[model samples]
Each structure stands twice: as structure tokens, then as C-alpha cells.
Target: MEFDLSWILLGLPLAFVLGWLASRFDLRQLRAENRQAPKAYFKGLNFLLNEQQDKAIDAFIEAVQNDPDTSELHFALGNLFRRRGEYNRAVRVHEHLLSRGDLGPADRDRAQHALALDFLKAGLLDRAEEALKPLEGTAFESEARLALLAIYERSRDWPQAAAITRKMQASGQGDFSARQAHYLCEQATAASAQGDEATAHTRLTEAMAAAPQAPRPRIELARQQHRQGQPGAAVDTLATLAAQAPGALPLATPLLIEAAAAAGRSAEALALLGRHYEQMPSLDLLEGLVALDRASGDATRPGRNRYVEHLAKEPSLVAATQWLATEQLEHEQFHPQIQRALDQAARPLMRYRCAACGFEARQHFWQCPGCQTWDSYPARRVEEL
Candidate 1:
């Protein structure tokens, strides 16, 4: 039987030609698509540089559509959407990247992080937390933990914040002792307010153990003790604080004096305050000493002499005002008005100021309200600073 040799020979060339044409067509299409993708991407970049964000986003979306497998394009598109405040679109872009089976581990993490950021920016805290939770084992672990900490803090979930901080501390990220102390102090405050004195005491004690150098715990514990009619214990606690955290003595001084007077330990309190004044020479310490002296009916020096001595050392307006307030002026008629004005001016100088953000407050804060920085406020007053 004739096997159609002629047809086979003819068909072979035809098949080869068909294959070649098909291959050429495919290559052309691929090159055209590749060129189109870059063209769109570059157009987007140009628009972005020109501050035409709307146009840039359109171009990026086009590029992403043309090059669906391009991770960089997806990232660019996601960021663009986020920058445009289109969190939903940003989330979609990042989520799509995360869903891809061929994504690298690092890229997967990046996508997850982007998704979290989108949710956070959109004020979707719950979704953001969920997105950030899986980032624990990735390079984004520290960043995710920090974000999670912020979330918990904003929600006033102290327990969760403490857990994250402890985890971060254990991982050697940085010291979170002070933050932990603050969380415990917050809990203590709440417990004390609820009439749970024992729980408050326990929490404050734990806070002190967590960060001995932190002043809030000791101060709070002493206040609690004073409230519970344990003024002697409160004075003892404050003395311990003055010894352990001397830089915080100014803040503890008034409380210490109150506790000492209530506990009939004015003599001991005066001695401790005098010692602190000798070492630190703070106006608050001097005030504490004077108050204690008056309460004990002991005149170590004239009540105004301490301010004079402080003025000689520091040239402080606050000190000068204190001295003048107690002095018999030649023009005594105007003294009251003058003292009131001087005191008003000095009040602001006595307030604490945050070093990081220049936020001024009457009380010293571990965190700056303006910038949310921890340990931003110096121990010294605005004038001292």
C-alpha cells in the first residue's frame, strides 16, 4: 500500500512553516506586551514625579494589568493606592500578591505588612491586627509587634500591650521595662479606683519590681499607702524612692512631706529633705524642707534663707520670688500684687517639658503626648532644662 509519501513530504514543510509562524507570532506578542508594561510603568513614574497622583495611579493600574506576575508593579500599585488614601484598593492589591502561590517568603511578608498598613490607615484595627499577627516569624516581626503594641495601647488593653512588650524584650529587641511599669501602674490606678486596695498594691509592687528606677510605681504605691492610712509606710516608701531614684525626688517631695506630717515623722522627714536639698538643691526639695520644718516647729534657718541660698547657687527667678514673698519689703503695699505676678510667671517655668517634641506639661510624663515617645520628658523642670 502506498503510504502517501508525497503528502507526508508536503505536510512536513507546512507543519514546520506553521510552527515557525506560530512561534514568531507568540514572540512578537510577548515583546509587545513587555514593552507596553514598561511604557505604562515609566508613564506612571513620570506622573508620580510630576505630582499627578491620580494619573500615576491609573498608569500603575494599567501596568499591573499588563504584567500580572510582576511583584514590583503590584507593590507600586498598592503603595500608590495607599498614598491616595484608597485603603480598600491598596488592601486588594496586597492581598492579591499574598494569595499568589509562587510568591517568595519575603514578598509574602511584605504583602502582609502592606495589607496591615492599609487596614491601619483605614482605621480597621481588628483586621490590621489579624494581618499583622502572622508576621511574627518573618523579618517584619519586630515592626509587627511594635504596631500590635500601639494597637493595644490605643485600645487601652494593657495586658496585651504588656505581653507584646515582654516578648519584644525577651527577643532582645530593646528594653521595655519602663513601658511594662507604666502598664502595671495604669492597672494599679484602675484597681485602686475600684476599691481593690490589695490588687492595686500588688500591681504597684510588681511594677516596682519590673522597673525599680521608674518613679511612677513608687509614687503610686506611696499614694495608695497614704490613702489607706498607712502614712508611716508611705513616708518609708518615698524615702526609699528618694534613695533609689534620686532624680525623681522633686516629684516625690510634696507627697513625702504630707506623709511625714500625717505620720508624725516630721523630724525624720525634715532631715531627709534637707539631705536631698543639699544634694540636689531643687526648689521643690527646699519647699519640702521648709514645710517639714514649720510642721515640726523647728527653725533650722529662717524659712526664707533656703531660697536665698538656692538663689546664690542657681540665680533662679523661682527662688528669688520665694525669697521676696517672705521678705518685709520697703514698699509692702505692692508686695502682694508683685508676688502674685511673679508666681504666675514662674509656674510655667516649674512645669516639665518633653525634650523630644517640646510638649510642656505641669507633670512629668514618661511618654510625650505630642510625639508619643517614651522617656521623652526630662526629670528637670522647664527652667532647669
Candidate 2:
């Protein structure tokens, strides 16, 4: 075959031109698709900023359909569904992401976390726990463990909570000793309620060993001792607590007074309480002092007069009520009414208040019932606070 040089030269440039034209057309098409994706994404963002969650979800859905490979958009849409309380839809989206083989490790972990959140929001605690378990070796380990701990606490699984706390402590998540002690105390309380005094005693001992500086263990242990007819041991325990955690002495004052009376250690308890009253002058400690004085056969006037002294230091209505309760009024007939009003006024002030959630209760709580916060209630009464 004869070669045609002119034709060959012309064909080479024509083919080159054709190839360039096709490449340009493909690039333009890709650019148009990319532009549509961002337009939908921005529309979703605008709707979200406007708090139109339904519209935002629609826009995001459109964006996701346009760019099916976009992991970020999928995550955003899933989270929006979760925020809107559409747990089922959120779970589906995150599960879809997880099913994708093309997803990176980080995205996979994020999808898992999002799925767990959906389950948690839906109150599917079992599923949530299962989802969170896999995140232990991942970057979300701390957060997942914390969530797990909360779940265990809410479920009253003391042993599980303690185990999680131990792991957190071992990981240097921060000192969880106090929390661990609380868990042990919770276990002890359950055991005591079930009449397992031996188990309760062991758990309480463990709690005290876990956090020696914590006042709850010592206080609880003393109460247990008193209940077991070991008033001397109870008094000794409270004395140790008063010496170590003096600020918590007010919380232990009533128990200490009872223990002292039972153990014939009134003089020693009186001296200890008097020393604390001099330093801090708490209403509870003052009450303890008055009780001890009365028990020791001190003069009636001087023993009850501590309330008047407390009133001199603090303008406390509770103190005034206490003082008036023991006083001989000039208008004796009207004294009952006045005392009743004062007593009513001081009743609310005697409540314990949660520092974290402002919840008030007649008795002290180591954990807040309102917000499920631990160690939120201070050892002082509301009026004292």
C-alpha cells in the first residue's frame, strides 16, 4: 500500500484536536456536577442557620444524592437527623456509611460514634453499649468510656461502673478514686438493704481504702458500726474523720453525738465538737455541742444558750428559732404562735441543696437526683450555704 504523507499529517492534527475537545467536554460536565453539589450543600447550610431543620434536611439529602461519595455530607445529614430526634433515620444513614467499603478508618469510627449516639438518644441502651464498645481502641475511647460509665451508673450497675472507672483511672483520664469509692459505697448500700451486713461491711472497707481522704466512706462506715452496736468503734471512726476532713465534721456531728452517748465518750466528743465550733462555728456542730453539754449534766441554761451565741455570730433565723424554743418568753401565751412561725421559716433553710443543680432535699445526698451528678451536694445546709 502506498503511503499518503499529506493525509497522514492532516489526520494526526485532526485526531489531536478531537481528543482535546472530548477532554474539555468531560471537564465541563464534571465542573457542572461539582457546582450542583456545593449549591445544594450551601442551601442546606443556610436552612440550618435559619433553624429550618426540615428544609435543611431536604437540602442535605439533595446534596448527598448529588455527591454520593461525600462522607462529610453523609455525617452532617446523619447528625442533623439525630438532632431532630429522627434516630431511625440517623441510624440508617450512619449504618449506610459503615457498610461502604470505600470509607476510611476515621470516617468509619465517626459513623460508629454517630450510630451509638442515635441509639443512646433513642434509649436503646443495649445497642448503644454494643456500639460504644468497639470505640475503646479508637480516638473516641475516652468519650465512649464516659458514656458507658454514665449508663452503668443510671442502671445501678455498681460493679460495672467501678470497672469502667478503674480503666479510666489506669488510662490517666484523671483521678477517679472518689468516683470509685462512691461506686463501692453504692454497692455497700445495696448489700445493707438486702441484709447482707458482711458483704456491706467488706464493700465499705474497700471504699475507705480506695479513697482515704473521702469523707463518705468514713461517715458510712461509722453509721454501719453504730448499727452493729459498736458505738465506740463508730465514735473512733468519726473522730478520725473529724481530724482528717474537718470540713465534713458538720455532716457527721449528729452521728458522732449519738455514738458518743452510746459509748460513754460524751466528754471526748464534746471537746472535739467544741474545737470544731471554735474554728468553723457551724450550726450543726453547735447543735452537737449543746447536745453533748446536756448529756454531760451541764447547767440547762448554759447548754441551750449556745443557740443565742450562734445568733450573735450569724443572723440565722434557724438559730433564733432554736433559741426561742427553749426560752421563757414574757408573753407566754403568744409565744407558741411566734415559735411556730419561726419554726416554719427555718424548716426550708434546714434542707440540703445540690450545688450542681440547685435541688433541695430534707436530707443530704451524695449524688444529685435531679441531674445525676456525683458529690454535687455540699455537706452544709441550704442556709449555711
Highest-lDDT candidate = 2
Q: For every model shown, what is its TM-score relative to the native structure?
A: 0.90, 0.92
Global local distance difference test of model 2: 0.92
Cα distance off (Å), candidate 2, residue 158: 1.5
Give the per-residue lDDT of model 2 (tens digit) for 1-385. Answer: 9888999999999999999999999999999999999999999999999999999999999999999999999999999999999999999999999999999999899899989989998999889999999999999999899999988998899999999999999999999999999999988999999999999999989988999999999999999999999999999999999888999999999999999899999899998998989999888898888887777777655777888888888889888888889899999999999999999999999999999889999988888999999989888888898
Write the residue-wise lDDT of candidate 1 on 1-385 in tens digits: 8687999989999999999999999999999998999999999999999999999999998998898899999999899899889998998889899999999999999999999999998999999999999999899999999999989988889999999999999999999999999999989989988999999999999999999899889999999899999999999999889889988888888888888889989888888888877887887787777676566565656677778778788978888887888899899999999999999999999998888779999987767888878778877888776
* Candidate no. 2 TM-score: 0.92
Q: Report the number of clashing residue pairs per model.
A: 0, 0
lDDT scores of the candidates, listed in order? 0.89, 0.92
Per-model C-alpha RMSD: 2.6, 2.4
Off by over 4 Å in 1: 1-21, 49-52, 296-300, 328-337
